[model samples]
Target chain A: MDLRPLKVSEVNNYIKRLLLSDMVLSNISVEGEISNFKHHYSGHMYFNLKDEKGKIKAVMFKGDNEKINFKLDEGMKIVATGYISVYEREGEYQLYVKDIRSSGIGELYRAFEELKNKLEQEGLFSQDKKKQIPFMPRKIGVVTSSTGAAIRDIITIIKRRFPPCNILIYPTLVQGINAPEEICRGLEYLDSRDDIDLIITGRGGGSIEELFAFNDEKLARTISKLKTPIISAVGHETDFTIADFVADLRAPTPSAAAELAVPDVMYLLKELDNKYDELKSIINKKIKAYKLELENLDTKLNLYSPLNQLKDKKIEIDNFLRDLTYVMEKKLNEKKAEILELKGKLELLNPNIAIDKGYGIIIDNRGKLVKSIDSVKLGDEIGIILRDGKVLSRVENIDEGEKIDEFNL
Target chain B: MNLTYEEAILELEKILDELESDDCTLKESIEKFKRGVILYNHCKDLISKAEGEIKILLEDEENTKEETFSMEV
Candidate 1:
């Protein structure tokens, strides 16, 4: 077969046109981890997206890159949708991405989650430590740019709903490089104000890099120390900042933070009117019921007086006294006869009669009355018992020791 | 007349909570019931309004897409 040699630029342009026209290649989704990411001055992003098997070059033009909600970092997993084309000058194929979004946890996000979980486990996010937002805030301090749309939106919504609420603006930078320190200072300023009932700190929607100030650990810790409730409103509804987790309450937007900081004045006024009417009716009913109770008591007062009860008690006492006197007099006569009988029995048992008949007792040293010579041992002390006298004696000899046996023979 | 469904729903919730609580007396309960009926009517009105609003937004989005495609062609 005969063939003609083709130039590199011609072949590349043909491939580029072919790739652009291929619908499958024009709108394709690729999943890989990003590496060697570079952002050019023109705002175009260049990066290599790789899987375990291979890697591909990718480029996101400025317009497409602006739509990314989060920062792109090396080693961050992403899913990119783009058209495939050959770069004519480099003669290399690359993906020209229209959209690139996070497919899994980026490195910074993973670090953020890790630190958040650690702090939460250490009890930093405990509900008991969270201060309650006041139901009716008198003065709300806001920490954001004085000229930014966030403060403007917050003030508008707050004033519209609750006209009486006062606002104190700390006016800190809500974005850019110096935003974190400015936010911290703003929080401190608001916290020092004794009149401030609560603080709402946040910014409007932005890229993750622009919202980085709210994700600072120092700012989050500062929010935790505020005596006034801190309501975090950072980024858009899809964005979450560290301040959101550490704050007492997290609102989806700056305007929402204002709404949460103070109750709707119209709703509150309606509730107050309802309560007032209910209280008035309750008080009126109570007054009428109390008057009726007093009237009923007045009617019973005439029939049931204290003097009537005392008169009935006096008659009962008199009847009880008469019965008591009769029973006492009968008991006294019966007791006198019993006393006389007891006196006669006592006289019959008197010892003077027995003593006059001349009976006597003899006792030894142990107080036994000895009646014979054998009753006590020789050399032992003895006591003689007589009708009216007692005598103590000691034995003179043992001659009588055999006398008892002789007398028996 | 300008009431939205979300507003009516919120009002009904408040009325229901008041009636269900022990704090309200029988007379208060009756008043809340009457207010709740008014809110229910407002909610019906708002639902009809939302249906119209959604249809309008959807048509606008469709027209914008058609216009973009024609310009591209």
Candidate 2:
């Protein structure tokens, strides 16, 4: 017999090392109903799992519990997988859970599957049955809890994305036994309204059981019958509910639902600006082309404009009129000089001037001037006239003399 | 001004096509340009005229009334 008096710490340390080294205790699984469950503020879970035969203390750290998709309740039946170990300070052995799953969740999932298949077979999940979401919904009808993160996220995002979109919230319970019916009523109420353009029904992230309200069969049928388009956003990204399949569209998160419900006003504003720019550019381009055409027509018509030829003809006529006026004036001056010279010669040939210079004239008896001897062969009477007096005489001629003296009269 | 954005845009497109074609005379161009100005103004006005107010519906058995509403949640 070997007997050694050892300290409590030493003994507890030895037991801890021994249990950790054992293969069966190092890796094992335990199934039990949870009691006295305490999820600590530090994110560590402490609980007691018990059955009719035995009981054990259990703990799950924050990191491992975060991987779980559901919450741990007091009466929940769970299957925990991890190693058994002794704590040296407390001198107690406990189960440190690395992985855990609800034992009854399998049944819930089974029901989910059965409903999904039934709906799929009924054509509720068909692509052809879904309604089209409007490009710019004037009003969005929301079916969700009025005081929660889901509604807050949806409102913030929708307002940020599209300010012009009006939201009509139907404040309904998102979970529990009556939540599905309330959701149905909310959806129905919004659908009945004429002003509602689109409907968004959902809640924030939650466990699978909490999201089961969206999986109700009656809710799916109500959604499928609605004329207005619907979008379902339940739980987190991985969660897919029956409402998601039946609705016109499915979003992974509440914020995502807001994004899908309406178009971004900034982007639409840009598109509107683009359309305006397109109109301006198209019309401006057309106007420029027309301007170029006008220029071409102007050049073609330049050949027909008689402005230059008319100007040249006007100058030629002015020159002809000036030359005609000059020639006529020269001819008039020559005529005046010739008339003056003829007047001087006419004045020198006047017989009245000779009479005034003392020249006399004679006439024969028959009132003829007998200036030549042959003309006075038997002249009986003759008349002689002076400048101031006249005398009458008779003449007889017996011999004709050829000798004649020059006389100036 | 009473036309929708789509109709207004369609007519504006027609005006552009007419101006682009060589068949239009000077008189026709002047007329179409005037009409184009009107259509452009209509399209611009439609975007600005989108009633952007937010409202909530309060319903009773007999009547329903609308009130302006805003909330963080």
Q: What are the lDDT figures for the candidates, one per model?
A: 0.74, 0.82
Q: What is the fnat value (0 to 1) for candidate 2?
A: 0.30
Question: Of the true interface contacts, what fraction does each candidate have?
Answer: 0.00, 0.30
Question: Candidate 2 at A193: error in angstroms?
Answer: 0.8
Model 1 lDDT per residue over A78-120, tens place: 9998889998999999999987657853655886788788778
Pairs with backbone N, CA or C atoms under 3 Å apart (clashes), candidate 1:
A361-A385, A362-A369, A362-A370, A363-A368, A363-A369, A363-A370
The CA lDDT at A366 in model 2 is: 68
Segments of candidate 2 deviating more than 4 angstroms: A1-102, A311-409, B1-68
- Please report how far candidate 2 places residue A93 from its true position, in Å: 24
Candidates in order, TM-scores: namely: 0.42, 0.56
Model 2: per-residue Cα lDDT over A1-409, one tens digit each: 8888999999999999999999999999999999999999998899999998989999999877765645689988988989999977899999999877678688789989999999999999999999998766778998998777988888888888877667888877787657888889889989999989899999988778678889999999999999999999998899999999998999999999999987776776676566557656755666787789889999877756788667778899998889988899888888888888998898898756777897657777667766776666555667777788878766776457755454543
